[model samples]
Structure formats: structure tokens, C-alpha cells
Target: MHDHEEHDEQDSGGGAAAPARAKLFLEGRYRKLCRDLPQTVFYCPECKGHPRRRRGCARCEGFGKLTRDSVQELVGWVAGKAFGTRKHKFHGAGREDVDVRMLGEGRPFVLELLGPRTFQVDLAALEAEINRRNEGRLEVRGLHWTERQRVVVLKETPHAKEYEARVAVELAPGDPRAAQALAAARALVGTRHTIIQHTPERVAHRRADKDRERWIEFLSVELEPEVEPEVAPAPALDAAPELDAAPALDAAPALDPAAATAAANGADAAPARTYWRVRLRTQHGTYVKEVLSGDSGKTRPCLAEWIGAPCRCVELDVTAILDEHGGAEEVVEPAPADDAPFGTGI
Candidate 1:
């Protein structure tokens, strides 16, 4: 009986020593091709992601997500199918807004696969499938093996991002005032400036309400007339083969056809809509949208303040992400012409 008791104790100890679960880390870079998609799938805000009853939830319109789909879901689904695991986590270097598309080589990310039944995977094939499955919405490149610690480095590293925003000035479209403002904005380019920015109102709820100072290393603004409905848009502005020595204006950038149509006619019939294609480089975590609108005076030295007009960021795109050593994980391909597609511009 004594020996049997000792054996039972040993069995209990071994059971307790068993591992909880297994996890696999796969790292790569991905481009978020649409402005309307989120980086992760979220539960219904009203339901707190948990449903009281089966079948459907009240919030999220029973879709179980605030949006239709996210980069996380898109990639995870395909990866899960390949790896034979239903549970996974997406870790991104940094996330862009739902309304902002990520271009360039794409943002660095790691996908953690839990309880993957299979370890063997062709990363190149997986990357191709991810891109092919999502098509124009998302693409993953430079897929490689990585460890869990990589997620930490990705999150903690301070990165710089280059961005493009299409801003609409309040001035009448044909007004010469547009030219003066454009020049003023252009002259400020290549001149480094610092500004104090409070957490923007849109994100204040989730972010700490505080002031942060950031530097704008380079900036350029160019004006373009809104293409009339009956008229076709001009050829897409050719992106420089390389980043320019100085910030150069892009008279043509991507625009939302619906928004452009709405603003096509101004009140005075003086060409209602004129857009400023703004390209800027800034430190990570800068609230770029607030940089243009001043966030109701929370952001100083804003474009709105300088031009003496109200401005808003109607379209935003992340053109590049750079490491501290100026190494880019991927390169940027030239964007297609204006008529290419809704969110194809880089």
C-alpha cells in the first residue's frame, strides 16, 4: 500500500507538470490594401464580443465584428486552414487607422498559431495563398520563421513612418488663393518643425488624454482640381523612382469617388472642390489627422492655422515604414494611375 501511494503521488505530480498548450510563431510583412479594413477582428462593442444568446448578437448586427473583416481575420483564416489550427493571434509592429491603408513593403507582423496540428509549411506558398485569397485587399511578403520574442521587438521598436493625406481646403476651387496657400505649405517642406499634439478627440476615449511633441522631418503639399463627373481624371502622377531629396508635390493622389463627387460643385460654381496631396514624414505615434485639422487647437502650428482655413484629412495612406537604421523590410512599388482603383495609390 505504501508503494502504491507513492506511485499515485508521482503520477499526480507528472500530470501537473504537463505543458498548458503549444504555440507557433510565424513572422512576415504585410500590406493593408484597403482603408476600410481593421488590423484585427473585434467583437461587437455593444455585446463586448460575447453573445448572450446563440445564432446572433444585438450589436455588430449579429456579425460579431464592428467591421465586416480585418487583416487579422483575413490572414489568420488562411493560415489556420493551412496549419490546421483555429486559434491564432496577430501581432503587428504598429497599426494604422481603419480608414487608412498601409502601402510600401507592408507592416511587419507575427502570427502566433496555437495548437497547430502541423509544423511543416511552405512559407512562400503560404504567402502566395494569403495574397491570392485576399486579392487586392491584403498582401503578405517576406514570410519567414521567427520566435515569440520577435513580437516583443516588433511592438517595442520605435519606427518612423511616411504618410500621404489628401486634404481639402475651404477656398473656392478656382480661387487663386489656393495657389498662395499651396506655396506656403510647399515652402514649409524640408524644414523640420515641432508641434504639441493632444490626443485627438476621435481616439481620446481609448488613448490617454495628454500632449505629446513630435517632429515633422519633411512635408510637401500640392493642389489638384476635382475631376468633374462628366470628365475623366488625368493620368496618375508618376511617383518618383526613389524618395525625393526634397518633398515634392503630387498634384494627383488617390481620392474617394463618392466624396469627390459630393464636393464637385462648390456653392459659388467657382470649382467647388480642390484637394491638396500632402506627403509628410513623422515619428511614430503621431496623430497625423490632427496635424491637419489642429484638433480644435490641440495641435499647434497646424496646416489649418498656417493657411487660415479649415482643413480635414479625407484620405490617408501609409507609404512606408522605416527602422532606426533606415532599413526597409520591403520596397514600394509605383502606384497605378488615377483610375486604377479606389485604394490602389501608394
Candidate 2:
């Protein structure tokens, strides 16, 4: 019977029929240095990565991608070389938009090497080699052997994230109403808010048209006047000759109810060319941009509503990602400098 079992194993290509394929699981963090870099390669929307010609493709213009490289490609290239395999899979805990910067300790990720020639490679050496190759463009750290199940945990786990956004307010400088608006913005701190957000118009093309509720653990805002020439003083209402005829009217026209409500809520007196800084903590998957502009009333109780003025998110950065144990990932650098702000020069 033992001889028969050995023959069966060899005949089935299990033992002597072929070499066993190896699998190596890795756990680590990836930091994206460039703002334009994405977490993964994006193929041409038209060809989906199969370019018909070498000279050029109409959709991708022969470049093959909207972007040249990504965190996934960088890490995969190094891992595949180390394992002597060209096929591998990259799994990240979460991803940031291409325009947004990923700072702090970096995002957790796992790389799965399939059909590797060997599993005897050193993870620490691999980490150093990968970092050395990518340099300032990308960095990987804390690489160690991990189990396949970790990918599921990282993908399904929900954790809060902290973000910093440079916001531009429609309020103007030197206006008395600016102080009131600033005060309202500051009041958002320490308040727990539940918000319902509709898909933002910018991303509605790919995202489902749906409403989702999210929680804001904390919010803080600060405003400063733009550095520009002082505005010319406005002529007094009494000095205007056209106003002299208005006193002759029997009575002033009735105020529109909508306008009256806006005034009462302090939303009518918006300032122009003013900017602010916001630090916010929110549950995973919350649309921070929509939270800023209200997405045309798609996001209820938004910052624009709180400040009683229209606002826009000029730049955004992920400052931290909290782990299940309430520990924060490594924060390599502080939040982006506020002096230049977003929409300003690099």
C-alpha cells in the first residue's frame, strides 16, 4: 500500500513529477513621495492596457497610461526581482487619490509573490533594496513575513483617518462679516457630526449615484487674509445720489423669504478671496471634498453650511491612519506647510 501511494503521488505530478511552486507573503508600508503618483497603474481607458500599435494609441497617445508609474509598480518590480518571479499581487490597506499626498508612517500593504523560484530571500534585505532603488520617489519599511489572511484583514478593516485640507472661502478680506464666519468655523472643533453625502459630481462618473452617511469625529478651522493691496473704501450709502430718490418711495420692497432666511443664518454675507486651513478626523471612506462644498446640498451639514459661506478644498493630505489598536502609523513628516497653502506655488 505504501508503494502504491508513492506511485500515485509521482504519477499525479505532486512529488517527482514537477517542482513545487512557492508562495511568499510580505507585510510593510508604502510612502508615495510624488503627488502625481497613484497607488496602482492605470491603463488606457480605451485599450485597457492592450495597445494595438507601438507608435501611438489614440486614447493613451501611445503612453499606455494616464500616469507613468505608481506605488504598486515600484514595489512589485523589486519584489518580483528578489523572488525570481515576474508575477505578484499588491494589496494596500486603503488608497489615496492621485492628487492627494500620503504622508506620515505610510499606508500598510502586502505583496504576494506567486510561483517564486525560492522562498529563502531575506525580507530585511529586500526592503532595503526596494527602498534604495525607489529612493525619494517611494519608500518601503518594516517588511516581514506575513500570512495570506493579512490581505483580507487589511482590506476589510475600517479605521479612522486624519486629513488636512487647504480651503478657499468666498468671503472677502477686511469685511466685518469675516469675523463672524471665522467664529462659526472654529465652532466645528470637538463636535461629533453625522453627515449624509451624495456622490460628488467630479467622481459621479465612476462611482455609483448614491447617498452614504459618515461620521466626523473632530474638525478645526483657521482663516487668514490674503496678502494683497488694500481695497478702496466703499462710498457711504447716504453719499450716493441714486439713493436719494429711494426715500421718496412709500415703502421698501418686501424681502424675499429665501434671502431673509439666508441672512438670518449668516449665510448671505460671504467674503471673497479669503482662505482657511482645516484639520479634520473622519470615519473611513468619507468624502472630504464633498464635506467642504456640500456638493450642491448633497452633503448635509457641511463646512460651507457651518461657516455660512461657499468653500472649496484646494489641496488635501492624509496626515495619519489609525490602526485597530488605536495606534497611528509612522508619520514621516508634518502636515503640509500652511504658509503657501494649497493653490499657491509648490
In the range 1-346, model 1's lDDT, one tens digit per residue, is: 0000122222355464433456777777889888789998866666666655313765676666788888999999998998899998999999999989999878988898887777666666778888988888999886666667778989998888889999988887768887777777888888778999988888876899999998775467877656757877676678536655655578557797776776775433553556889998877788899888898899998988888778888999999998653346443332334234322332
- What TM-score does structure 2 among the candidates reach? 0.73
Models 1 onward score TM values of 0.77, 0.73
Leading candidate by lDDT: 1
Residue 88 lDDT in model 1? 88
Each model's lDDT: 0.77, 0.76
What's model 1's TM-score? 0.77
